[model samples]
Target: MAKKTNKYIKPFKNIFVFILLMFVVWMLFFDANSWLIHHELNSDIEDLEAEKEFYKNEIIKDKKAIKELSTEEGVEKLAREKYYMKQENEEIFIIEYQDSLPKNKEK
Candidate 1:
């Protein structure tokens, strides 16, 4: 009986020690804060990459616009639309939107 009990107890002790060691290792290296921080850093890196891609596309668009503006026709069209420039005798009219009024009656 004593031998049988000793054999069973020995196995249980080994299992308990293994579990304890694993728990210690997990607490030291795989805690909640470490996982959270890693996830946050990953998200931040993803956001930065997206921002970089957006800027890259914006640079391409700006380069294309610059190339277009370097030509005479493109410059004249831009001036006509943006600056409202016209021929010497042309008149300019300004129109205001009704939505530009304040929402509050008191104001």
Candidate 2:
């Protein structure tokens, strides 16, 4: 009958719509280059930008330190601390007591 055929057509149309909707959802979320992937890439870019800012600040600090090292006292201090350089006939005595100190217990 015509009524029976019309009922079948309606269900088929609904199924087609559902399939199209699912396909769109799959493409938006499950595809290789999807919206979620773009969001992750944006987050990665933000993190890299933050790291770039941190490195820029560090570079500024290093330039300041290099400028200071150009002076005589700063160079001598750096040599004594890092390379353990001593003046002629002067002895260097390093006293390490931090390891011997008692550590505080956490409550």
**Highest-scoring model, lDDT:** 2
| Candidate 2: RMSD to truth | 5.9
lDDT per residue for candidate 1 within 1-107, as digits (tens), equals 54555664675478788798788778656887565678888999999999999999999999999999999999999998899898899897877688986578674
Model 1, residue 7: displacement in angstroms? 15
Question: Residue by residue across 11-80, what tens digits does model 2's lDDT show?
Answer: 5478788798788899899999889999999999999999999999999999999998999999999999
Task: State the local distance difference test value for candidate 1.
Answer: 0.85
**Superposed model 1: Cα runs more than 4 Å off:** 1-33, 91-107
C-alpha RMSD for every candidate: 5.5, 5.9
Report, for every candidate in turn, its global Cα lDDT versus the true structure.
0.85, 0.91
User: Which 10 residues in a row give candidate 1 its minimum summed lDDT?
Assistant: 1-10
Q: How high is each candidate's TM-score?
A: 0.57, 0.61
